[model samples]
Target: MSQAADRLALGRIGESVRREDATPKVTGEFAYGSDLSAPGMLWGRTLRSPHAHARIVAVDVAAAVALPGVHAVLLHGDVPGAKAYGLEFPDQPVLAGDRVRYYGEPVAIVAADGPERARRAVAAIRVEYELLEPVVDPARATEQPPLHPDRPTMRHGYREDPRPNVIRHLVIRHGDPDVVGDVSVTGVYELAGQDQAFLGPESGLAVPDGEGGVDVYVATQWLHVDRAQVAPCLGLEPEQVRIHLAGVGGAFGGREDLSMQIHAAMLALYTGRPVRMVYDREESFVGHVHRHPARLEYEHRATREGKLVCVRARIVLDGGAYASSSTAVIANSTAFAVGPYRVDNALLDGTVVYTNNPPSGAMRGFGAPQVCFAAEAQMDRLAAALGIDPVELRLLNALAPGDRLPTGQLLTGSLPTAEVIRRAAALPVPAPEPLPRDPLRLPGGAGNTTHGDGIRRGVGFAVGFKNICFSEGFDDSCAARVVLRADGRAEIHCAAADVGQGSASVILQVARTELGTDDVVLAPATTASVGSAGSTSASRMTWMAAGAVRDACREALAERERTGGADVDVEHVFRHPQTLPLDPETGQVTGARAHVALAVAAMRVVVEVDVDLGLARVVWVGVAQDVGKAINPRSVEGQIEGGIAQGLGHALMEELVVRDGRILNASFTDYLIPTALDMPPVTIDLVEEPEPDAPYGVKGVGEPPTVVSTAAVTSALRDATGLLLARVPVRPEDVALGSR
Candidate 1:
């Protein structure tokens, strides 16, 4: 193909293709996971431990088994094969056998004819527990008893000490670690645990095939991985367990980990009947993992002219109970610890430790957002110390193409860091309305807590970047099958889970663009139909899935041409360029690359603070992202807006409060997320700087908006209040109490 064709925009790639599931989703006709039901399906309920740390002394299921409506009562002994499962390591037990390490660890399960009956049976199942002191602090994890022993048998080749609770401790030393600059600023930032708070609760339906196998319909991020993990626990082969994707409400990384997938299948297989499990709002909070709460200490060194010299950071992540993708999270945090800036010398250490807190796993932005907050804060401090404009300072140090990351990976792809920052900073700020207007304009809004008595406005800026695909030698690939039908239409088959990131629409758009036909059909994502399309995560779906679809379509078209316009079917697996694992001692990746590509975002946030009432409201968010390409402009804008809203919630209100490792606010009434009123108006600048290797020059756009929005908002708050705010979900008390 010539360069002219590569530059041409045709079919649906750049057009705003209407979402296939939009109408059904908005009209309430879509059958989400919670809406799935089977005829004669029994309800499944799990009995969770009440104590965060306790010994399971005895379990008597006689009462539950005797219940008239109950079909099955299962305990630890009931697990037929594997007793543990996880994405990275099999550490979390299918059912707690001896001791429960977390407050909501599943101890037993009950299947009954109805939901209420299952709940009653769960209550009736007698279980005796001896309470133990909980290790709830990540800072003190090394002094606590070993959560998962650090022996050779348990270690999965990742570097770690024989400490009590440390899961992975990654150290990176690049350039001159001992380099000192003319000026230095140090700060410590703390981030709270945040929930995905997806609207749909975890739900699933499982039915026995009456042939020693089962069919499961569940809302999850990866169907093949679920099948692999569930089949082992059920004592069945992967083929025996067919997994289908139910309609997902939203994932945002919450559904990346297993939830009710196995429980529903276990009950269905044991009872010889269909089983359904739907977690209520309260149960959903404890059922899935939350974002890891992070504590980061950063020191930024720069010359008097505000030129960055060196950066050193120590990041600690609380990996509650089990190691679910903790190693990957730590790697990302360490790699992007210094933000999207050029640092000559750096020293970094990132660690994730086991504790009795609620389990923390994948969340939007992965682990980069936590460190971004700290790094951006340090940048602002440095700018203040150097007496320079924050935006100018960031622009001066912005990473560019050919720049080397702290991981030692050469930026061979597009690195528009300075461009993104410049565009964001140049966005026009919204003008203020007349005073004595609506009380809703105040921070307290209709509550009338403040009538514009002491409101002040400030603007702030931040930039963040992260690896676009799974890093560290993960075998990431996507399989696609394209069939050019006799009617000149194309059908695409792939098991890429659409967790509300518009992967389905993106796949169809890619097919239409490649096949040069508007009549493209996207098949439902299922493991029984296609090979693994990998997880819809790491912002790799668009690149991997679309690449596979394009490859398969090209083969199908070529075959059709060879056969004189006959129908042709082709299957292909799109593999990313190999990424190497980081060297343990030096923290540098030695191979060609550690990440496929990097996606950068810059944000300028406007915030209004009411010092008297200690309430703050984000006014506007101006975000500039280098997306390489926009498959659909509307969807890209929606993703950016949604991400900014979520990020704003993280900055101001969303916090999963825990006391002694127990979640205090599990329901929405207690936990706060950004409502429509809380979200600021987002203005997005889509910068098309295509990666030469990506399909259609597409880079990930989902996680970057979220990565820096929080920092920008926090920086604004600091500007308005003149206080060094070091913690997230900045409460009104923090603002009001520390008011100057």
Candidate 2:
């Protein structure tokens, strides 16, 4: 074909194509980060603080050093340059120093011949500690002393009150606060702590480069950030600590913070041998950060006609013991406190407090999911009190194009909250049949308790929306290189972590259509080829990476057209629009780089609750999300289906139970996530609205199902039991006792 014809026939942004990673993932052949291993690599382990809050009185590393096969033991004294480091704040010690604030806080590390030897070495080390009072609750954080004095309430680090336990404080004010309405709904919502429950625990290998530097291979989200954090503690230059992402099992924001990176690197550098560290299931909970548990107080005032007039919210997130992404999480939680609705006046004050609990940081939903549950549930309550159809009421307040968010950032592109919710609600409802005296498909599903006797049914809907890309303008971006090879295939080089979201597949599908090649090879992502694609959180990778990959492909095609070549490769970067910092005092206008990517809104859950047993079964979960354009319709469906399943688990069965700041259910057997047998077949309605700015018009599909599913299930439980059901994974006693 002629160059002109080929250029004209190139796939535009909305076509469908095959994903490159589909085969490997499904066949169980893909190697996750934990699967990575090195020859003669030593295993590593960490000795943690038994007391949640304690002062380090003394440490005797001699016992551990004397142990056979123990190669190295490292601690804060071993740290070369920076004593503390964090994603946004340099408040958390890489290894605990003068004091330990959480039970899982690492004070010492050990590397040996095997994971068992490393574990035993840790037991041998004697550490003297003076116990301090543990602050377990975020609400009680302000009254107590702070965990770190360096971090304060405001953006000006120097101006903050030297109080304990307040890492980040954010306030957002929008419009005239003078606006008020007579009818209002005020309530406090409590969100429990969540674990990523990522199947593979943290694993990494630090291979010395024969220089003073080391090449660290690990499963992580941000390659650059990990390097930046690890290098400072190791007292090495940033370039010296080369971070390579290994095959990740599933991060879900758990791997966002450093787990085994620096420890393994330090050991490898000291021993002059490759060192590897992998966390056991129990160790995984202590090894990584969990999702912040939140307490939110929401006051919503609306006109009698259901027009949102004013909103006042105070959100307190439990940033357990460290300042890991606490600043960003607080900003997001407060900024979107009113949800994706049109509120004329909003006073949102959010606080992230340090507590001697398990460390919490970025999760898939960032700070938005916790707020979404409260906001949407409040919407339901408002609808009930005002006698408005919940669907119609939501549509009235849904933020459309050109809407100004609570953060004062204008919502751009296809803001389809109204369309998405409507489509989801329009799905045909399932009719329940009168089961015979014998019951096979009841709540317990073939279990003897599956009897239909005490079952009560209710359908509930929740409309949830989240900002797609990283907000507040940190210049968060991604880089991708697309090479159309002579083998009649296209290859995408991007370091965007998939985290089991199939971003690699999505990128391949985008490439296949763009270059019109069926055989698409997605090169294993590495920092060598692509620039930092940022973390896979915030649902941005699909949009940002695809934009870069497609742009590079287009550039390659243009170059090939001019040079008359069949194969061409090009690379490009996709940066999100920039955002500004929030004004400290008045919470007035601050420049924000907020752009709406693709809103994959979802509505879920019809359920039957046996109020007697506090046992509830989801009858079905119906989801509606705008994929903008499905590059691969099948994969798009997979994302929605998978996200809903995860959300279902969060709503009904998943939580990391922490007692006295210690994770009680770290293993899968104790801390239950959903199995296929646990989930109902999710009914999905694909709402296709082509996003003008995205490549192939594809909207983000991984997060919205998760965003909306929890609320829907919780809402359904409320309807079934006629109880408030304020918390998730509803307890049987609550249903049986008819507790509110």
**Candidate 2: 10-residue stretch with minimal lDDT:** 1-10
Tens-digit lDDT track of model 1 for 265-319: 8889999999989999988999899899999999999999888999999999999
Q: List TM-score per model, in order.
A: 0.97, 0.93
Off by over 4 Å in 2: 1-27, 152-163, 437-440, 482-491, 518-520, 560-570, 592-600
Candidate 2 on 194-251: residue-level lDDT in tens?
8888887888788888889998888898887888888988899877887877777877
Error of 1 at 339 (Å): 0.6
- Kindly report which residue stretches of model 1 are placed more than 4 angstroms away from their true locations once superposed: 1-11, 150-154
In model 1, the clashing pairs are none
